[model samples]
Target: MTNSRQKIKKKQQDVVRFLEANKIEFEEVDITMSEEQRQWMYKNVPPEKKPTQGNPLPPQIFNGDRYCGDYDSFFESKESNTVFSFLGLKPRLASKAEP
Candidate 1:
């Protein structure tokens, strides 16, 4: 089985191809990094194993802050509620519930 990074890379490639075929204008960002480099950057990185059910998505860095999202937006946004829903989690409520 391919790692999450590898899987995302493949999907990116597919998107690029689809865009090119349709004459869409876009820029492709290559965020691929070596395993050693990733380890040096992040401590306690998990091994590249097959993803399991309910496995939390990876961490993301945005505007100098670290956040976690679902596999879809994990590498993109830190403010997306879709990520929370994807992980079977609910957004926190601001007001307390009344009994």
Candidate 2:
């Protein structure tokens, strides 16, 4: 594999590992294998969310149809409930309440 491909693959793996550690389920889409998805992501996701020069490539995270930024943004959200809130989820499973 080319150097670029290896780098991208590693980034993807890092993000996936983060999700798993946080108990967040996600779907992985290898854009190189799907041009339709690539076009859709670039079109649907706002330009501001696009990667600037020298930043990481794809492997972006989305909440349903909404863009949730990249891996750095995910970790940055540690100070707030944005991550769980964006995913429409609670940080961790809560105990059952008494009737």
Candidate 3:
């Protein structure tokens, strides 16, 4: 696969892995399988978020009809420990594990 494709795949995997690890429910939409879904994603993404040259790529995060963000934003939130808020999810309560 091309480098771009590889990067996209890696990003998608990272997002999925994190969500799975945290037990967050998510729907993985494959735009390639349905043009309607693809168009809906493109349309839902804000104009400011879209690339200047072409349509936005996959792995776009959302909460129902609410637009969360793209991979870059997701990564940023992850790094800053705010991914739950970024995903529009309430953070889970801490369990008693000596902390």
Candidate 4:
């Protein structure tokens, strides 16, 4: 496979790892090579929400019917602990261990 493909695959794996580690269940889809899904995305998603890439890649997320951006946005949400709230899950409270 090409370097770009390798990179995309790695990113995809990383995102899955993060979700699993957090005990968050998610669905994965590969639209990179799916013309049918691409057409569906073009129609269902707003143009701005779509990536500016050649083939708008996968990892496109949706909470019910609302688009939640891509993996990058997902990561951002995870980092900020916003994903938990976004998914209607209780945010984990940080343990206050005396240092």
Pairwise TM-score winner, candidates 3 and 4: 3
Best candidate, lDDT = 3
C-alpha displacement of 2 in model 4, angstroms?
A: 7.8
lDDT (CA) per prediction? 0.41, 0.72, 0.94, 0.71
Q: Rank the candidates by TM-score, best first.
A: 3, 2, 4, 1
1-99 per-residue lDDT for model 4 (tens digits): 578778778878987887799877777767766878677766666678766875456556666666766778777887897987655567777769889
Candidate 2 vs candidate 3, TM-score winner: 3
- Rank the candidate models, highest lDDT first: 3, 2, 4, 1
Worst 10 residues of 3 by lDDT: 1-10
Per-residue alpha-carbon lDDT of candidate 2 for residues 26-52, written as tens digits (9 for 90 to 100): 898877789898877777666777667
Instruction: State the lDDT of candidate 3 residue by residue for 1-99, as single tens digits.
Output: 479888988999999999999999889998989999999999999999999989999789999999999999999999999999999999888867895
lDDT head-to-head 1 vs 3, winner: 3
Q: List the residue pairs that clash in candidate 4.
A: none
| Backbone clashes in model 4 | 0
TM-score per model over all chains: 0.32, 0.69, 0.91, 0.64
* All models, RMSD in angstroms: 12.1, 3.9, 2.8, 5.3
Backbone collision count in every prediction?
A: 0, 0, 0, 0
Model 4 misses residue 80 by how many Å? Answer: 1.8
